[model samples]
Target: MGALDYLSNFCTVTTTRTKHKAMQTVEIKVRMDCDGCERRVRNAVTSLKGVKSVEVNRKQSRVVVSGYVDPNKVLKRVRSTGKVRAKFWPYVEQHLVYYPYAPGAYDRRAPSGYVRNVVQAFPDHSSNAPPQENFLSFFSDDNVHACSIM
Candidate 1:
């Protein structure tokens, strides 16, 4: 068989296009005490491919990354920067310590195992003076009759 005949018998050609996944936002909770910790976490996350933006909130110790990157991969990358305690945002919620699931704590119709602290305001019965008009007036303008002076 000639070269053309041999090639036709042994090979086939096809073209395929890969569809890139849409980018998504991933929020991670990292307890960064200072600017260095925040910088490290930011650098680690931004280094990943397809990262669109990185937002760091030092007060809340939160990092928000937007891109086509996988969340798990981003988490791994952040942890690789010597931060072993990194966790997803929702997983770090304050009430999660008491209730792992929303239905357990957040749901109003759920059982009573959820311990939610509710504050009820009770007017002081001892005071009928329409409450102190200026609570701060006690400290700001020291009264000559102040009991503490004694």
Candidate 2:
């Protein structure tokens, strides 16, 4: 019984560590006016521990970091590079958006296929189709208590 208990504890610890080190991809948007700006952002993020790869697109001002690091930590690291403060990439591919041209979801500076992701992320229960109503449900003539008028 003691051996079983020890195995269970070891398994729990392994699971917790695996969860914490899961690979994640974080996308950040920072204004890069020139080659130097792009280089700075890339180098800054690449130096972080556990970062597997960093891709920077100067035109779209996007930096995609793939690794096993906390997302908030990656964002903070990017901001420390002495460039324009970074923001999590708020845009999604235009093709993935339910309403690509939604008023606040469209950005002029986003990449050709991407749009700001301001549309609702979850379905609103209030907007769902109302429950089907039966016109005869209110009448009880079919039952034992038929109306006298009938």
List candidate 1 stretches off by more than 4 Å: 1-5, 8-16, 91-150
- Ten contiguous residues with the weakest lDDT in model 1: 114-123
lDDT tens per residue, model 1, 13-84: 776987896889998877889888888889989889899999998876678999898899999998998989
Give per-model TM-scores.
Answer: 0.54, 0.67
TM-score of candidate 1 versus the correct structure, residues matched by position: 0.54
Task: Show how many residue pairs clash in every candidate, following the order shown.
Answer: 0, 0
For all candidates in order, the CA lDDT equals 0.71, 0.82
Model 2 score (lDDT): 0.82
